[model samples]
Target: MNFARTKEEQDRLEQIGELAVRFSERAGKIDEAGDFPYENMEDLKKAGYTTWTLDKEFGGKGISLYEFLLYQEKIAEGDGSTALAIGWHMGTMMDLSTRRPWNQNVWKEVVEKVKKGALINTAATEPQTGSPTRGGLPQTTAVFENGQWVINGRKTHTTLSPVLDFILVKAYIPQRKKVGIFLIPKETKGVSVEETWNTISMRGTGSHDLLLKDVRIDEKYFVETVDPVNNQSAGWLLHIPACYLGIAGAARNYALRFSTEYSPNSIEGTISDLPNIRHLIGQMELELLQARTFMYAIAEKWDRSESKVELQAALGAVKHVAVNASIRVVDAAMRIAGSKSLFFENPLQRYYRDIRAGLHNPPMDDAVIAMLAQKALDGIQN
Candidate 1:
């Protein structure tokens, strides 16, 4: 099912997949303790995954979107929380490398840091407004003071904030009344993580509160104007669906293995021989097949196409369909596992809980449905 185009791409994915397998050995324990998977991040860096998506001109692998999505799925197979958290950095860095908005010196430093395995994430969510993608203005304020931009605000759900070397803050200048993103180094004064992430799903991700009180940085740190009205096709977000699909794949594999081996005294053969269990396995296979087909096909198309259609609706649908399918597949796997799936040590329960969290991620279910309805109505009017 992999679509790696080059030997280098194949070798890179194989290396990442190997690291992901090692990471999986600790995934359950990490979840139970609710701690960030710092080891997993470090392992990925050592495998050169951090620079896989960076442009070749920057002394990196420069993998394509299709290849990146495939590796993301591989990583999720080992640990979903880590996959989701780091995908933000991987995708954003790839996006920024080409269409950089900041000065060359600033961009050059960022590229160097990334090459050296530095993690970065956009801190756009706020306690007041939630995800900035919904067209809500950020309450975080920035002001120019003595050749420096002083920022004061708090952001919620800042995933991987603890390990991040650079934090991109979306803020408004009070004096100019203009909104823009300001980059803040982790060591900048008055910048800290508030240690507030405690969740049932994706608990290994340190998506805590990022607090910045009068965080001062050079004025050149302000970079990239986020325009909600004229956003380009977000093909990078395909990683979201890929991660969940990988989780579902793990659950499916577990169920299959258990069914083949487990036998009760009352049963003449393994549960896998039962018609109902076979039916459930068939169903899970179909779900994964459909999800993988859509995600990879669209990803490859995005890479090869010169121009892309309006992708907001497609991106929303991709997340909605793939996540829901993964959730359903996990549920089926649990049913096949019967009571064993409920055990604390079983991976099925973890998969079930982790997949549920994707329902709350950005491009929410309601927004996707609303967009579909509007598009349908507009088609009728036309």
Candidate 2:
């Protein structure tokens, strides 16, 4: 597939790149203070990047999946935490906007809010269950009564919850085996944010727990579920690889810069001139190039058609490759940097910590391995 960006896409990428540089400079401070990257989000809002995934009909740029991933990779390269936090909203919007079967009026309202700078986040992960990966249904239930639904449950790992204007929550409808997504306003009664996230990695993401006690919403706010097999939802899966690829690129860049500039009195020249250091940089660059190719290939395929099974497998592979590659590249950077890389004062340590979180993200290793095995078995059966 031709991965070249169009003129318009190229222009927008440059603009987002400038913003990302500014965001990266502040990422360290926010990570040190363990505070949310509020300034970075505000910059995204001003740039209208918050609505990049929304439909043009709904007052958005309506960029393609390929372009979206490219932009995400650029932003993530600057600051993985900010990219991870902002990606949830953008990816969610892209999924909701592109997927059909939604009520027209409700869709319109949600899109308008997004256009007006309302950030949306996924409130799915819970305290008891890390993520809905191992057959665990949501304890969060939305009871239908009096022509409305009352949602009551606590959600953990609610990324960007502090500044989110609205949240898309997945809740179980009582007596039904199905799960429904509800659009809940942040200011709704009984909805509160708990500051529970204090992790060594991605500390600036502000992924806290959400307390939704008796939060009521009209029936129209519920997003009906379609058949998982038939439904097309590639945008959500693609964002993970996009974010991780950017991080890998960042690691490569950091290593390159350090090798070129830092010199020891014991050495005749900078580390970049050394054969061993140059070889490591080349290896990291090769990994990034290959991972990015796979990532964009899957994205372009999604743009062309809705193939959930194939897309899911491809996305799983991409995430697996990109994230693991990122970790390796960061580790290589740290190894090359030596003892100084271990200090909190160095940005390399932050990158090292942030890249590891990708391993725990959805489309986990075990699941991906099983899925790949199933594909192999099916191939043999045919």
Candidate 3:
């Protein structure tokens, strides 16, 4: 299958690359202020990036998964937080387009809104529930009443809520014995935002708590039952790895720059001249290549209509490799840079913090290890 980007997609990627460079320059300040990267998002929107994965039927470019991941990696290399935040939007759009059981009318309306630049996000995580895994079984519920659904619950880690036009909320329908997704408008009644995101890394992501007390949604906004297991492969699962990949790349680039410029008084030469420094850089490069190769391979496979079950296992492995590599790369950067890397003003510290967030993502270390062990045992039995 052809993996090369069409000329139009290539031009769009170049534009996104430019935006990423500018966003990177301001990322440190945004993290220090713990403010949302509104300006950066606007730039992304202007570049048609917000709709990068939207369906072509909806007047979007509808780029394949492989192309999308490549673009994500480039943007991430520029600014991890900005890429991390926007990744959710792209993933959300992909799910809405390809996975969520939306009817024709609902799809038409949502597609129209998306064409108008509406941003969607998943408000699935909660304070009581650590991750969306073990079932997104919400402490929240939506009751049907007066020709609409009334939603009530507190959702934590609702990333990008500040700028979201609509949120895809998971809530249980008591009478139906079903959990469904509701497209709740941000301006809906009883929807409130709580400034609860105080983190050492990815501060610019604006992952705050959402208090939904009697947030009403029209019946037309309800989508069909979402398969809990199948949701894992719907493109959004790639975002966590993409974020860490970007962070790892940034850390590697910084180390290279530091080695070439900084001259230690005792060494009597730049660190770049040292064999040890070159060795570390080589190791970092190897890890980056391995992680990226695994990620893009799965993406390419998916784009070619591969089986979801097999890809799910591969996705878990990719996350483990990418996140682990990110941690090692950042650690090496700090050690090579010495005391200067610890300063709050330096980007390395932020990379260190942001990479840790991947540890909390789904298909976590323990789960991935168990899955791999089970697969190995199954192979032995076979």
**TM-score top scorer:** 1
Tell me the TM-score of model 1. Answer: 0.96
**Candidate that beats the other on TM-score, 2 or 3, i.e. the better one:** 2
Give the TM-score ranking, best first.
Answer: 1, 2, 3
Full-model lDDT, candidate 3: 0.82
Higher-scoring candidate on lDDT, 2 or 3: 2
Write the residue-wise lDDT of candidate 1 on 1-382 in tens digits: 5667789878878887888888789999999999999999998888788888888998887888889898998899989999999899999887787566688899889889888899999898888887676877889999899999889999999999879999999997779767889888999889989989888899988999999998999888988667643446678878889889989988998999999999998899899999999999999999998888877878877788776665567777888889999999999999999999999999889999999999888778898899888888988999
- Candidate 3 has its poorest 10 consecutive residues by lDDT at 1-10
lDDT of each: 0.87, 0.83, 0.82
Candidate 1 backbone collisions, by pair: none
The model with the greater lDDT, 1 or 2, is 1
User: Each model's TM-score, in the order given?
Assistant: 0.96, 0.95, 0.94
True lDDT of residue 7, candidate 2: 85
Q: Write the per-residue lDDT of candidate 3 for residues 107-149, one digit (tens) a residue.
A: 7777787777788888888877667775657778889998989
* Superposed Cα deviation of residue 23, candidate 3 (Å): 0.6
lDDT, residue 301, candidate 1: 77
Error of 2 at 241 (Å): 1.8
State model 2's lDDT: 0.83
Q: How many backbone clashes does candidate 3 have?
A: 0
